[model samples]
Target: MTEKIAIQTKNISKRYVIGTKNSKPNTLAGEIINFISTPIRNFKKLRSLSNNTTDNTKTIWALQDIDLTINEKEIVGIIGSNGSGKSTLLKILSKITIPTTGEALINGKVGSLLEVGTGFHDELTGRENIFLNGTILGMNKKEVEENLDKIISFSGVSNFIDTPVKRYSNGMRVRLAFAVAAYLEPEILIIDEVLAVGDSSFQKQCLGKMDDVAKSGRTVLFVSHNMESIMTLCTRVIWIDEGKIIKDGDPVSVVNEYLETTNTISETNINLENINKRGGDGSIKFTNLTIMDKNQKEKTQFNIGDTLNLSISLKAIEKGLLNSNLTIKILIKNQNNTTVLSFNNESYNHFIKLDDKNNKIQFSIPKLPLGQGLYSISLEVWVNGGKADTVGDVGVFESTPGDFIGNGIPDQEHSLFHTNSVWS
Candidate 1:
């Protein structure tokens, strides 16, 4: 028998009207008056237009002409930058909002966690909301009873189960909300970036729950900014930009293309006119900073195991040089602003040296642990045990997928550190 398609969309689109107030009249008389004064309004708008015009009354297409299909038991990842419509797509799939046009077909029940505390009532106690959300998802009372204890225990909020949700801390709220959604046993699961709110341990638990759900042959639609999570969990990936699908294929390839196209570095003359210093006792300032590849050319091409060398030039501004130390930090992030690897100044403090002349601070990562995808870097300079200057608006590079002839695992041998792997 042929496998069934779990979800499918034809020309799905969502448009949001921004900067226009609801008080704008919608009657026929109002329309005629606005139409007659269109020319004068146009002239006034042109005169008052500025850089912030994009923020004024304008229409933004969150999702446009998006066509997709997912097979049963498939785990698909949606990757994009902020406002790229990843969450908006999930919201539509969950029936939280209707599409502006087109049709969506879902083959099974869908459980969604779009935002923190979504599908929850602050006035209701944690226990009450569990039943309420489950019922909303079509579960009867007996079914919810069978899973009540398991959900409460999994959330690690047994002590606060009877307390009102509004009184819970932010972390507690996320734990409860995630527990409820994950336990619903829906045939299709849709998750947003809510996993980012919990602590590291809690995040690990959530990843395990998702893995179990996938193992049960259920379809999962996950949206996140963490490339590591996407590579580790997804069977396939889709990249979206400016409300359009740019690439859809294997996770590594799609992520690599998105990173390469977004981050571009050139050899233009260094401009320090608008440099901002980070908070700390000012002992040193970064005079110059540039990223270069192994060939000494300013480029952003890299691979999974490639070596990246960052060259930074700095100078001592104060003469009273005590036991001052120089440090370098490197952060690897995806297009969604999720951080994968963060190396700070303290990690390289042992290699500091005193220099009266222009000093070059060099830090190199022998082999990038990330898989094939796009990653950006954030650099920081420290002096006298405090941050001096930080620069990180446009530092990015691409990691091409390596040759791994084995199973689907990429060059990175380790899974997302969030999983618990043990032999039974």
Candidate 2:
């Protein structure tokens, strides 16, 4: 069977000039004139991007020669570091921004949620905005009316359906915006990291909705930092770096590569003092992390069944915190960003007292059950029932094949971790 292309981009590139200024209109009439001529000015600038090459320092390319073809019903996940142009490509596909050179060709109507409150009017009620967005998608009032209730219910914002969008919080706006976009039944759906604004439950709901949309013979383009969600929902993955395609293929292979190359800490020992804190108050802070083997020799690689050791140093910043009931936790996740193992002092009813000068903790796994793959570690500290300090991806370790069972058959094919089993 032949595949139908839903979206295509040929040599698509976008350039932004730094320090460029636009004059604001002073009067209502001037504002109206500016709005009408803005498209012409943008077109001229886009055209000039091809011929003007005088000052390269002033311009930055967000995308370069991005050629892609997405077939119908294909859910593609786009992953990259910040400023890698994932959002720029989405904006171009949504018509929110114009590319400096080349063009993006898209078939069928597109519904996009690039950012919070996008395509929504501040003064318009959530109900009104639904119809407005549907209209923008070329749907009539009756069609929007048919799905209005479902959208509101799914968004869980039925209570504020009649409230002006400006009065809604960021989460509320995201909920409503996603409902309208998903329920509108566009042929292609484009979603950015805006879903991160919603809570975990809502994010799950949105992912499920995207899955349903794909099952119905539509196309989905998702951009997110959540590797698990990307692997679960997307059949294909694309990695972008420095405004170019670095990798694109199977979800597992692409995601594993991206995580290993981008998130892995090559050093066996990492200084946590300078690492940015992800959450919790500033009462306590992790100072350092060291990964080692059974011999206490620092190493980043270990064989399966080999002992894994970790030493974490922490210090209290506030007075009396050392005496407080503190709980320490270590979380390990696979290359897919899914938590594989977790250890906490509180879980085992292990009470630990901290000293003012000696505030180091050690954790050891007698037999590393992990297969041949990279794993990340996260550290957390809680004081007196409140979170004191927390950080993610503090360190990474690689596990290689080893003799777990008597007959050493490599067993990382279907599972992340290996376990011994006996056959009767």
Candidate 3:
């Protein structure tokens, strides 16, 4: 049995020119002279675009030697850090931009929701734009009308379907755009990170719809930073870093590798303000984190049965938030990126009071139950049922198996977590 190929890219690469700035002259007379010669300099720079003598230092290769073959019915997820060329590759596939030195052959019609309001006319009503998109996808009027009701109902924008698209809010526009891209039935659907603009409930609905599309034997290309969504929805995953394919394989393995590589914090005492790999709306910020023992001494190494304590400091961005309640959570994951233990205040109906009297949280584990291994810590804070801040890999600690089961001899590789039991 042979599977049909839906998209293929051969040596696909994209390049962009980096702008350079001229040094400002200190003297007024020097500035005047430099300003007088600006036109000639601009002319030479403009002319250099068509010449072969371009400075390699002033240009960046957004993609390099990207060879990929995506088959029909496979939902592939592309993940990477910011400026890692994830969006550029999607743009190339959507025909929004062309590669510098390669070709991408697509077998079927592609419906792309790369950005909010993409492929939609601002002046056109939502109803009219639905037909416009269908027409662009080579569908006739009857074909579009057949699915028009489904699209409108699924978008939850039936009330505003007759309104101009420009008048719609960002969330409304995303809902309608996603509904159109999904219900219109393009053979290949490409979605970027625009779903972050919608509400949580809407995002879940979109994920469900994407799953349905995958079951219908259509190809889906999804780009998102949400690792859980990628793991659940994607059949395969592709990790991109610095414009090149880092890993492509099973979703769990690839995502684990990506998270391990991107998590750079490894010390016991960590400053959280500088890390860029965090999420949430930033209404609450994690300022500092420390791993300590019962004596309040900081350390990164602990025995399997030792008492461990985590101290965290948070700051509210707005003064009004100081009076609100906050739900704090911490997750502990092994080196393989599997969460072995998680602590959430809300699970027990306990929440931290955000007031001037208290802004610090301390979580203590009396007897660590984990076997000998390395583990990472992830932090999350929520307010008003929304995520205020989330940071992964905030710190890491090493554990050594030390009589956790009350035996003289400890087995290090017996299991990931230690447990107490009695044989019948």
Candidate 4:
């Protein structure tokens, strides 16, 4: 039997027109002067004038020559840097934006959560928006009412169901939006990075919901920076760079290649610009960061039971008697923002002293329990016992497949944090 493809695209591309500045000016007098000098400018162009065409107008191709096929019941991840055409592809797949050229064919109804609070009316109560979103998904009013309680409970916004969406907090809005989209029972689901906005518990619930949806034989197209999520939820992965697909294959391999190509900081290179910044007040900033193995080489690959070292350098601006503390938060998030391993400074803190000199802080994980995939590192520095600066998703490192030789269970022991591990 031939398996049906849930989503297919061919030669798909998107283009944008950009205007350039004209020093010749828009005023009548300036136009007259420019007209008089047009012949001179033409002569200059003949003599290889600095291609002023780019200064006046240009075109940007957000996506080009994208050919992809997603099989039925498959969960595929689109991983790339910001503006790498991931969201653009999802938008096209979801029919939010038409491709400038070529065609995108989706086999079933798609439920998309492209942006936070999308497909929602601020003036309408949560209860009203649920029905509106369901109708948009091709569901009838009776169907929406039947699932109303389930949606409210999943969204954790039961108390705010009657309240207007305008009164909901940003987190509340995200929960409601995700709930409505996921509960629509669409045959295909397209999600951008909006899942990262919710709280930890909410994110977990969303991941579980997505797992259930995929297991029920629906197709899912997910775009996320969380490598762990990509590895866990996606059966296949596509990496887009500069509006083109660079690699497409197994989730682990694609994620590793993407991180290596994007991150220039080697195991030895500890530079702030290379690492991903998590969260902070932007007072004290990380200037350099490096992660290495026991050999102290610029290591990128780690296996189970391997000791990983993270060294961070920070600089303090306008220094006072700051309560300097360095924290390394290890986050293992799946494509849907499900956190499998989250270790903070309090879990493993290393105090440091900062006095106008560059400070280096190191956190060593003697043995990693995580299976094969990518993990993100977050660094936080506190000044005077308060939150000073934070950097999240700064850099991603790869973890290779390894044995579960440890005696303890995966989640309970930091050395065995598997995304799909079940606790009895």
TM-score per prediction, in order, is 0.58, 0.57, 0.62, 0.59
For candidate 2, list the clashing residue pairs, or say none. none
lDDT per model, in order? 0.72, 0.82, 0.83, 0.72
Name the candidate that leads on TM-score.
Answer: 3
TM-score of 4: 0.59
Q: Report the C-alpha lDDT of model 4 over 76-192, residue by residue, as the tens digit.
A: 999886667888898888787788789988898788877755568999999999888778766789888888888889888898899999999988888887887777778888888
Task: For model 4, give the 10-residue run with minimal summed lDDT.
Answer: 48-57
Residues 1-424, candidate 2, lDDT per residue (tens digit)? 9999999999999887543335567789999999999999888667655555557754778899999999998999999866688999999999988888898889988887776455689999999998887777657899889988898899899999999989999888888877877776778888888656588899889878877877888788999888888888898999998689999999999988987686665688888888642457657889889999999999999888889999888887754577778899999987656688999998889887777787888889988998788888988899899887888877888888776664666444645677777789
Q: Give the local distance difference test score of model 2.
A: 0.82
Cα RMSD for predicted model 3: 11.0
Model 3 residue 280 CA deviation in Å: 23
| Number of backbone collisions per candidate | 0, 0, 0, 25
Candidate 1 residue spans exceeding 4 A from truth: 20-57, 264-336, 339-424
Residue 354 lDDT (model 1): 55
- The digit string of per-residue lDDT tens for model 3 on 362-382 reads 889988888777788999998
Query: Residue 376, candidate 3: how far off, in angstroms?
Result: 13
- The deviation in Å at residue 164 for candidate 3 is 3.2
Q: Which stretches of candidate 3 lie over 4 Å from their true place?
A: 43-53, 119-123, 133-140, 264-424
